[model samples]
Target: MPCAAARACPSFLDKSIHPHVLRHSCAMSLLQAGIDTTVIALWLGHAGVRSTDAYVHADMTIKEKALALNTPVTAQPGHYQPTDKALAFLDRL
Candidate 1:
């Protein structure tokens, strides 16, 4: 069949392209292009970053590259100790 011949091309071999698959492909391509997750989420009409996080979290290479680019902070991590007077003032607010 002429249609079958067209499908024989490896690029067009997958005939089961679902809408979600197309959405995922577009999101992944945008992510790989260094677009921000917030912008991608907005473009995809996601309600929040939680939805877009799946695309970012799914790709380990991006995570590794981000980690590699960050300089480690030497400052000690600790909770802020508010004085009793400051605590009382915040409580009033």
Candidate 2:
């Protein structure tokens, strides 16, 4: 699915680009350029600098995190059993 941010900001993005990857790249590039988080936030149309703060304080551990992201993840498909509390809530709905 296209990101909601992409849908909301058609002018800022290429229609073919996925937002998370490109957005992460853009944020990292701005950080490397020494741009302030507040400015990045405004450029990305976020409501606050806090939304952009992740890139500002990122550490070398980011490489480790990126490596983790590149690894494949597998999960066995199975049915989910909702808790009794969830069932009760669904019944109420």
- Among the numbered candidates, top TM-score falls to 1
Q: Give the TM-scores of the predictions, in the order they appear.
A: 0.61, 0.43
Flag regions of model 2 displaced more than 4 Å: 1-17, 61-93
Q: Report the number of the highest-lDDT candidate.
A: 1
lDDT of 1 by residue, 1-93 (tens): 435645677556556667899999999999988999999999999999889999998988798678666736864444358999999999999
Residue pairs with colliding backbones in model 2 are none
The positional error of residue 19 in candidate 2, measured at the CA in angstroms, is 2.1
Query: What's the CA error at residue 7 for candidate 1, in Å?
Result: 4.9
Residue 28 C-alpha lDDT in model 1: 93
